[model samples]
Target: MNSPLSPIDFEDKRLKIKFKLEKRLQKELQALTKDPPTGVKVDAESIYRNLSEWIVDIDGAPESLYEGEKFKLMFKFGSRYPFDSPQVMFIGENIPLHPHVYSNGHICLSILTDDWSPALSVQSVCLSVVSMLSSCKEKKRPPDNSFYVKTCSKNPKKTRWWYHGK
Candidate 1:
C-alpha cells in the first residue's frame, strides 16, 4: 500500500512548491517591469510587497469614454498560479462603468473564469482589460450588477459567469 507523506515531507514539498511559484512570479515581474503594455502600469512596491498579489493601474484609452480616468486592478495569485488563473478584479474608489463590470468590482471576462490559459501572463491580462475598456461602445454597468454585487461571493473566481459577446 502507498504511504502518506510524513509531516516533515509534507512541509518540504510545500516549500518546494512555493519556491517554484515564486520563481515563476519573479520572472513575470521582471518582464512586466521591463516592458508593460500601453496604458497598464504597476509599481515595484505592490509586486514586491507580496509576490502572490499585485496591484496594477490602467489609464483609459485616449479616445475612450473613460479617457483621462484611471482604474486599479487587483490580481491575487495562489500557489497553483500559471497552472490556474489569478483572481483579477477592479478595485479602489472608482470602478469603470462598463457593461461587463459589476459595481463591486467583479468582472465577467471569460479568460478570468472558464477560458483561462496557462500561456496567458499578467501583462496579457492587463492588456485584455485595457482592450475591454477601449472597445466599450457605451459606459454602463452590467445589467445584473445590483443583484450580483449584493449576493455574490467575495472571491470572484467562485462565480460561474456566462460571458456573452465580449
Candidate 2:
C-alpha cells in the first residue's frame, strides 16, 4: 500500500516551484538590464523588489505616425513565464491611437497572444511593437474600439482578441 502526499508536502512543492521561477526571472532581468533593446527602457525600481511586474518606457519610431511620442507599457508575468506570454498593455495618459491599439490601452498584437513562443524575449516583443507602429498608415483606433473599451476587462490578458492580418 502507498501513502498519499500530505498538505505540507504539497506546500513544499509549491514553494520550490516558486523559488525556481523567481530565480529564472532574476536572471532574465539581469540580462535585460545589461543590454536592453532599442527604444525600450525597463523600470529598474520595480525589478529590484519583484520579478513578476515590470514597467517599460518606449519611444515611438522616427518618421512613423507616432514619431516623437512616448509610451509606457506595463508587463505582468505569471509563474509560468517564458512558457506563458506576459500580460502587456499600454499604461499612462498618452495611449497610442493606432487602429490595433484600443482606447483603453489594450493592444491587438498577434505575438502577444496566439503567436507567442517561448523563444520570444522581452526585447523581441518590444521590437515587434515598434515595428507594428512603424508600419501603420493611419492614426486611428480599431473599428469596434468604442464597444470593446466599454466591455473589456481592465486586464488585457483576460480578453480574447481577434487578430487581423498585418
Which candidate gets the maximum TM-score versus the true structure? 1
For each candidate in turn, the TM-score is: 0.93, 0.90
Residue pairs that clash (backbone atoms under 3 angstroms), model 1: none
Give me the runs in candidate 1 sitting further than 4 Å from their true place.
1-6
Per-residue lDDT tens digits of candidate 2, residues 65-137?
Answer: 8889999988888878778899989999989989899988899998898889988877788889889989999
Instruction: Show how many residue pairs clash in every candidate, following the order shown.
Output: 0, 0
Clashing pairs in 2: none
Candidate 2's displacement at residue 6, Å, is 3.7
| lDDT (Cα, tens digit) per residue for candidate 1, span 121-160 | 8999998888898999989988888999989999999998
- Highest lDDT scorer: 1
- Residue 136 displacement (Å), model 1: 0.6
For model 2, state the Cα shift of residue 41 in Å: 0.5
